[model samples]
Target: KLQMTREEVLHDIAELTSYAKEHYSTVLFSAEDATRSDLNFLIKANQIAVENGATRINIPDTVGTITPNAFGYIVRKNYEALPKNVRIAVHCHNDFGLAVANTIAGFENGASEAQTTIIGLGERAGNASFEETAMSLYALYRIPMNINTRKIFPTAKLIESYCGGKIKIGRLQPLIGQNAFAHESGIHAHGMIKHARVYEPITPELIGIRRSDEVEQIVKQSIKLGKHTGGHALKAKLEDLGIHPTNEQFQKIFNHVKSFGDKGHEVMEEDFLAIVKDVMGELPEEEQYVKIDELTVLTGSVTPTSTVRLKIKNNGDQIEKTASSIGVGPVDASMKAIVKCFEPMSKVKLLEYNIDAITGGTDALGHVSIELMDLETNQIVQSSATHEDIVMSSVLALLKGLNKIMKDKNSKN
Candidate 1:
């Protein structure tokens, strides 16, 4: 399949490198599937390239099956056999979750450069993750890499946007995942309360996760009270929120959280706050930041359109606004109209709206879940509501998410 013999391949390398040297000041050569290729031939191919003027030789673990020890040996052999003037680079693939380890091994063995893709994008199995590898070298190995460490989170987000939903990075992914710094276990939360570094390998600030100026904000987000939560964990999180309660109030909240978690629900941040406020008698109707006066939508064989009357509180000053917009459906129209009144809100953009019918019938109750994200800070909030009218349900869930974002934003000021 190569379409050429060994002698012909070396001849082509010589011709290509010689020809490219005239125009390009730098010439890099790579032997495809070098790890699996015959070592002598690969070395000879690379030697011929350098003799003809190649400045760099890239060794690729094309099949992604090479072990770290084997990869280190290959890099070392190539580093020793190849001319001292040329730089050696390793291109590893994560077929076995060893791309990061292999790339680091190359550095530890002698390879001068690392070839990686953001989020480890590549064919089939991904290549070495630039963020993971660079962070490992910078943080774990203490290798002072020349990159703006703070931009790691944003750059990954930009790449995700470019992917356009094709490649979604899970929240549990290291370094950039939402839960990477989130502590969910009772013991982990207790340890985190004592010292961040006790559970977190690094501080959130090292990766630009400063969502608030208050340490309590950071602490509250990190400790997720869930099924594994204990009384101590609950107390720690409540104290972070500055909520001091009577023993009875504390017992009531604790039982509620345990019961909720017992039913397989990992209570979210907004839901947790609602629970605390309800128990504290602070859940006044007036506490709602935005309220809908009225919402009307017209559809059925026409452009789906809606209009709304809304009263929103801006810094304790009630403001009334009315607006209308057209959408693909009545639900979309109604939600947009509601969002219009809360216009000039924060950069919290609607990410997703999902609905599931709990029963199979025309009058089946539908549960709606909505996610809103602050584009600037990438903070996400989720809310849900169940109702017979799906449109109203979506609006309620979206508003809940928006209210959470508003409360969080306002808390900072």
Candidate 2:
């Protein structure tokens, strides 16, 4: 299947068509890499196959090398030239992530049938994914497909287990990726809980992935919660126990726990929520901290140096601070500098740092959150961020967590 000559391909299709006709009701002749081979040779070969008994002629763009317009044009031309009795089919690969696009084009142009496999599974990249194809046709192209959208995830899970590997859903992978249904903005989350269409194209549940699972799995996963056990995990725990916090309220509590965890300290729920109210109380009136001006970091030696200059205002009081320090690494040094300037009067100490990337490749962003313990009272603080720069994210997250912790503390009085 990997490599075959024109003669061999023709002979194989002829044999297959004969066998299919005798054994089954109808047959389709699929010439692999039909678009790449000499068109004249393929046309003659297909003609012979159809003459013998092939009910359909399939053209495959094996490498996703053709644009949709070209693909459609070719399929339409081929179908029109071929005998009326023979239907046309299109098979596409996703080498350039345009498999869906090409498939749509083929269908629109002339192909009545699509030869598709799940998740575009094939060699040297993959084939056109059945779920993505179906979703795109139904959702984007307004084409009708018989597939039930809800069956996608279960089908994928089964295939993945049988294949003995994981399906790496790219952050941009439509419909099924972890980030696909994620909403980071508070408004989006609130809207999703009320009605998913506010942010998601289709309710994740429509794909057999329930909202609870999506929330508890993907949302909590993003926050370093769930099985990975970070801030969202605490949030999950709190929610399960019927302890609900408003968006701003939870932000403060979560930041409290993340700060401590980032410093390497694991905490119990009693310790986790004790400082929640205190942190929530310190949040800025508009629910935003000083916008990060910039940070310069130098590390990879005995000691690391990090300098952060921030532009901030409390009420109407504007202030700026530039500080530097040498510590374990850029993240550590950055946090140290931020804590000194941003929360100089606070006594929170980072006890743990945990960072994980949801996906792979050089472009993936690290989702970081941490735990901290106030040196003065042992109260915990935590916070998290998704960023391409882990060190920078870590510093900003720490400051955010500290600010929340102080806010909640001040509010208690």
Candidate 3:
């Protein structure tokens, strides 16, 4: 979405306004890729748009790179640089999954208007989603957007047809998705069935969506479990099979999930729990367990090497073991080495990997998050970890994340 360097955007106001004057009623001028271009040029462009009678000047953060605070600052700075008569608008992309955050930031900074497609549909990742932005603005910020909340569904369908990706409907999805209204767990469903206000903060009808009868029938079938048996909450309970986790273990898994995000993947449950027990051996007692002994990784190639060594106190005796392996990369190698040493203990699998950088610098540490899906239960397990060396961070982070998933899973069991 670059505005400079492109003749179309640079000359859009001059050529498009004449066409609008003859036939169209309004002209929307967007300076795409505004975030990456020179700010001085943008100010001049904004002046031109207003001079050409453009009703709106749209500034888009196409890369999803700006934080909410930064977004607000950008809008405020740019708007101040522009002629007062030009109406500022915003179009945001969700590449970093922060479109909603950025949109709010724009409003707080100075934007009086926004352009959003239903379900956030657009190219590359998509624009700021209408449902998330509208509801967030209304519910969280108390911004008065006069658009009818009830029109969300039809609007989403209309945009979905023109766009490529599917707009999955559900409650877990925020506003208009299917699960947004259907309660399935025993405690949640019972409370919701009695008084929906107990679980649902907003009415389904408010977003122009209806709870599917089929989902309700499925809940009825789950009556044997009474109410707390389906959905993610129930799935979480099942993950906690029978175990208490140490604070260290918990932090480890939490870090892993964050690391997975860096790599652009969701965390699952099975791989999470399995890796926990895989590394630490029988759950740590109040004071009887040894800490992680040693981990070495050789990375940056099609194949990598990993070595792990651990020492544990058993029956007043110190026992030690080492494992090593070669795999796709350092991460895979390290995981294999750990498994080799801890085999016959339990099975583990990796479901997803995501990663993101904490800061923008060569020295900035990258956070890696992982999701391990439990094959038996079909539940998602999450963990996150970080390091300056992305690969090493990924391996250690995954191990820590794995530990957390297992610790939580065992606790519930």
Candidate 4:
């Protein structure tokens, strides 16, 4: 219908309304670009449709060009000009980023229903978002809605997945985005630690989500270690990690972290923990039973092999031993060699070994966590180490766990 005249549109609507009334229980007459239509003619068209049996009239901002105040004014005009029995609905687009605003405005003035889509999925700039509209209505206007708030995230995720790139949720999108409830800054985290409401408009639990304290603490510690750090903050972070370093050890760890920051390197949590371990010494005095003197590994297309030299202390005497082994990989071979060297103490078996890159890039920190079982004592222990070399990190973690098991056995004896 190019250059549709008001009279022609009204004549068509009257005929459609009459036909719809006989066959359908309800009829809705939607005026495309209603905001731009002649107000007087628009009112007449709506009245004719309602008189002929249309149940509702919808006013849509087709190109999304109208302001909230203007939209409210138009809705108010239609509300007054139309018959008292007719219902009004508003369909708004987000070209001007005011669809929700205009929708709420129209509802506040007189509209009874709103037209919305999930995550504002529609043509061009899209339509008003149901989540935004429903949440705003309930939270800001005190309007009670029967929406299940907990299902909001799950539903949004399903829709987003089905869209398959047609719609992308903004990282900072309100309520459901990844960063919606994430706090990165130390100041913000500090405030949130005291009272979450200070930084968050609503708790994540209200939306069926749980806040990650470990992630938040990692961010807070990263910021402090990467930028300017205070003694209190540093102490708190170390204490949180269950590492109560002595005064001298604290000074060394702090200086090492600051040096890394000054060199333009990110001091991650793993890096800080590694620094603390290096400064405080690997094992406590009583737990110092076995130590790695030297290790060499050879791998690649050829058979993987390793040689390990270890120093074991017993009754103030140091005994050194060397062992060699072959396995599927460098880490496996190294573990076999270390176990061979410590065969006299206990039958130590590496039950589990896991490694993760703590940071990006080829020089990323490799964090190795291992679970060791002492078959002789039937005791299990877990420990971890972080380093740039995966094999060394794994060996160190295994040795740490072995030391714990040996220390416990000695204390019992």
Model 2 residue 338 CA deviation (Å) reads 20
Top-lDDT candidate index? 4
lDDT of 1 by residue, 1-413 (tens): 67998889988899999999988989989888888988878888888999999999999998799899999988888888987889999999999989999999999888878999988889888999988998889898998777888887788888999998999888888888878888767788777766677777777667667643234755666677667887777887788778998887788788766665676666676557656654564223555677778888899999999998877777878888898989999998988887766766665678898887654656544567778887766889888765557887787777777677777777786
| Model 1 stretches astray by more than 4 angstroms | 211-215, 281-413
- Native-vs-model 1 lDDT? 0.80
Between prediction 3 and prediction 4, which has the larger TM-score? 4
Clashes of 4: 0
lDDT of each: 0.80, 0.68, 0.63, 0.80
lDDT of 4: 0.80
Better of 1 and 4 by TM-score: 1
Stretches of candidate 2 exceeding 4 Å from the true structure = 1-16, 141-144, 190-195, 212-413
For each candidate in turn, the TM-score is: 0.67, 0.55, 0.46, 0.61
lDDT for each residue of candidate 2 in 132-194, tens digit (9 for 90 to 100): 778777787787767788889888767767876656545656676666765544444545444
Q: Evaluate residue 150 in candidate 1 and report its C-alpha lDDT on the 0 to 100 scale.
A: 81
Kindly list the per-residue Cα lDDT of model 3 for residues 21-134, writing each as its tens digit: 567657767776878767777767776776777777788997777778877877998788777766788988889888878888898888988778677777788778888888
Better of 1 and 2 by lDDT: 1
- Of 1 and 2, the candidate ahead on TM-score is 1
Location of the lowest summed lDDT over 10 successive residues in candidate 4: 215-224
Candidate 3 Cα RMSD after full superposition onto the native fold (Å): 15.7
How many residue pairs clash per model? 0, 43, 72, 0
